[model samples]
Target chain A: MELEFVDIRVERDYFLIQGAGIFAPGIHLVSGRVGSGKTTLAMIAAGLKTPDSGRVKRHGIGSVMLSMQFPEQHLTGSTLESEIASWHLQPCPVLALAGLPGREKDDPFSLSRGELKRLHLACILSRRFDLLILDEPFSALDCREKMATADRIGSIRAGITLIFTHENQHLPRVDYLWEIRESALEFLGSVPDALVGWKNKPSVLADLHKRGVYPKNLSTADILEAACRTHD
Target chain B: MQDARLRLLTVIILSVASFMSVAGALAAFIWWIIFTPGIRTIAKSPFALFFLGFTASVSAVIWLTGGDGISYLVRMAVILLLAFYAYTDRAPGDFLDLSVWLFGKKIGFDIGLAAEMSLQGMEVLSDEARRTRVAFRLKAIKFGFRSIAPSAGLMIYSQFARAEEQADLLAVRGYRGGGMVCPQFTRVKGDVIASTSAILPLIFAIMPVGDIFILLQ
Candidate 1:
């Protein structure tokens, strides 16, 4: 599915986004400083929020799901099992998919932060949407679930994926990159093609990467391989 | 079709509510008459009297519906009122908050866990805010018509700074949500004594006044 916006403007008290468009199919890795309207742009694209001017046109079949930054806010059910079930028209196997088998009977509120994030992501991934919107999704997961999610996203790179992140998180087999600059989006080519820009990335991300002691690539596999090779 | 246990719990909960409603109405009506003998608040308080009267009437209806009649209704209303009087001095807010805390601790998540989980998302917001602020400080540009962004940026930055620190603090403890699977509640001596001595009278008082079992006594 492809989404085209001719010229869109979203105005917030502290920030504004003007003239944003996406003409890609795979993951569009979005990065920006705070208040760049990256999230607003994503939400507007997904039809969750409306733009002040310009048109947002969607040429796709299937659904668009916006997985939020928090898991508990998304929990409408008082119980864990019902919350997952309420996500779909039918029963959802998310409890098992999220590797939370027995916790189905347990309360959602009672799960750890990382566990809740995983459970929420499992719900998002369980259904196929034309566009999958995940905002800062890599927060609270262990290395394993993070890898698991990245792999799942990579395999199903079938739909349009808009991932908003501040971390130099390896894009899950992405096609394009958009940096939110001064409340507007700046195109940074494709993932590996955009490696040059990664070198010049701010110290915040680069420092973490240095501390992580991994390769300079923006994908988990490359980092993993580099680490394993170092060990060997 | 409620399970027997659920029905029993429901009966207890509703009966308490019913008793409280009547007592509240009585207090309001009396307060209006005594304090504001000619005040509008007193006059307006009579509505609660109507409401409580309606509730007591409903208890009567419930009594009759269960195949019990006037003697049952009067007795139940009397019992409920008596229970209300006996518990009159108890602060409602403290009692309810205590129950909420106790229930949260007992069956659902504990206060610490709920507070922790609720605060986790705030971390995500704060992180995003902090990054946005750092970038803002890096660029330090004054963009017009988008004052909102910077404001949100600053707010998020401050909130996250405080929140992430709190999250770090929480991690210092074993806060893995289910880390402290609560100790299973067993009826101890205090519980048994409380149930037998204190709660039995309250229970009978809450029972709609005219059940043959209660009336026979």
Candidate 2:
């Protein structure tokens, strides 16, 4: 199932987001300031949040899975085992994938932040969801877990997927970069391509661009490597 | 940064709502607002909520069971134990900390006591620290452990002395028992949800026909 945000707009006590749309399949990055409504937009897109005046058009019949920024937030299971076992597909492996190395009987709260996130994702992937929404999926992950999760998610297939994050570098290759700036949604092109002459490109990237060696995609890795190349 | 406590307060608000059972999809909708910080910060109220839930559940069960003498004695014993447990010597801040752990971190401050203590602790600490700094300068101290520790100790001593003096002062004055003033707490969007959650059980309890079908274990 494809998820569509049809002119989605919202106005709450402090948040006022308007006219935003996110089309999915392949990873999508949502970046915004603290209150720019990046989360609000992601929530609305994933059907977890309702917009003041828009509809989440679930294009096909599908289930919705939301990976909360804090994996513990989504933990409804009493124990790790039950939660892992709660998945539709064989839930065991996903629990392992989440770095919860033992069986599912552990307390979900005992796992570290990254482990919890991975566990949440494993649950999402093990099930068949048309769309999976992950909020700040890499917040507390160590370097290894970060890359491992990126690789794992990079390997998955779903109808539409939305990931909210600020770390532009760690994200897998994606179809679009949706930025919530001042509560407005701006859809840049594909991740690698969308970042072309991107305004939000880091200072190092700007420096690289000045040196006439602009990357295909000016992500963290691309920019850092370009900086090193220029230095060398 | 202090104003940003609102966001943290948001979590407690939502958890309280969850505690009151405004859950399923609506709870899921606001889940991230609570979850992101809560996973990282942990809530202050989860345990308290759990205890409250257990108490409420037990009360409900007792009400249903029609209060036999043995069961009534058992229930009274349990209540006495719980009351005793609440009054035992807790660490200075453990009650708030427990509230935080119980509720989940983000929403931990939902227990008004924890939030109030947090703010008061900061204020008192700040006053003490400022007084210490002034004393340190009077002693012509530089930034080193030797100079700093003595000054800090003196400052803390003075703060305690002042606290005792204030207690005496309060006794001399026409002060009643209770506490001091706190910042006015305005309910954010989440508090409204909690209020609604409180009312929800009443609504559910009233729907005898459908609720009985679901409640029939």
Candidate 3:
């Protein structure tokens, strides 16, 4: 499955976000600064917002889902059971996965932000969509939860997944790297090669680059492996 | 209107006049065209759909009851249009400035602060509602009568959460009550002209149609 943006342009009062790229079936990591149109690009890709010009062409993609930045925005159910059920999934398994197994009777809003984010992510990840766009999936998560979420994301084998985040740490193993710079989305090529051209890269990656060591992927484990290679 | 006081006064007069009579409604429409931004801006508001739905439903009811449905629809539409204009043209502290200028530092300050906060809350509510709609679309859940309860529940919960956060912020800022704020307003020639013309609608509403015709003659 592939999703293509054919010269998509979104005009705002101050700046315009214009880009063209094709997202193939794999984990694509999109990094950008805050208020740099990351959410806008995600929304456009999800078909929620129409671009001012150009078109988004989805090939062999039947279902699409966008997990917004704020988990509270996804709360449509009063109880945890109803919340999981809203996504058309079984409450027991989802609650178990979210680490709130017996809290089905509790209100979803009553959960802390991190807990809510976990529940939201669990619901979105429970279903396998052809196109899955996660916008800042790690924002309200703790370090452990972020790592767990990243691992869960990395385990998905099929379909296209686009992750829009400013998160420097706890990233899943990505196939491609893209970034929005000066109000434009630039494709920096695949994996380790892409890391060299990444301007807003994480400190670890920068350090590794300085030492002439490149990681196989963006995952924390890969970075650690690259760090150990420096000693070798 | 640049001046909040004059704008508030114009809104009140135009609303009353429009509700009072058909001639008054016509006058208000003319004033709206001349003074307020434009009909296009008001039509773009999220509340515009609600207003149209409400007016249509009420007008249908009136027609069924053998009342003057058309006239009622016209008058109500004009009144809602005036409200939309006022809401769109409003600055952040416009109502607060007007209230403080009208009342004293203690009572006026409290009232103005309340007004300002309420307006800000409305903006936040609008944004939340839009996001909720988008979320509903993403989940492929059709928004109908069954969904109203959940939507309302989310709105109420969010409002309470925001109110608590605002209270905490105010406490952190050492807010007691009745703070000092000098309300300033910039009046242009157009503001004065618009404010003056707004009175014509009230006069038309108060005077008989025959009397207005004679005066025109």
Q: List DockQ for all candidates.
A: 0.02, 0.02, 0.70
Q: Candidate 3 A-chain TM?
A: 0.97
Runs in model 2 lying further than 4 Å from the true structure: A22-24, A89-91, A217-232, B1-217
- Cα lDDT tens digits, model 3, A82-175, are 8788899999999999999899989877899999999999999999999999999999999999999999999888899999999998999999
Candidate 2 global TM-score: 0.51
lDDT tens per residue, model 2, B71-142? 333333333322222222123444454455455544553563545455455456565554444333322345
Q: For this target, which candidate reaches the highest TM-score against the unseen true structure?
A: 3
In order, what lDDT does every prediction score?
Answer: 0.56, 0.55, 0.91
Worst 10 residues of 1 chain A by lDDT: A196-205
- lDDT score at residue A82, model 1, on the 0-100 scale: 61
Candidate 2 vs candidate 3: which has greater DockQ?
Answer: 3
Docking level for model 1: incorrect
TM-score of 1: 0.48
- Model 2 lDDT per residue over A1-232, tens place: 4567788779967767885464766677666666566666766765556888977787674666666565544433456775554453455677666656665667665566666777777676565556777777777887776766666666666566677777655655456777766677788778666666266655555666678765644334555566667443
Query: Candidate 1, DockQ to 2 decimals?
Result: 0.02
Worst 10 residues of 3 chain B by lDDT: B36-45
**Distance from true position, residue B151, model 3, in Å?**
2.2
Q: Which ranges of candidate 1 are over 4 A from the true structure?
A: A89-92, A169-171, A198-217, A224-232, B1-217
RMSD of 3: 1.6
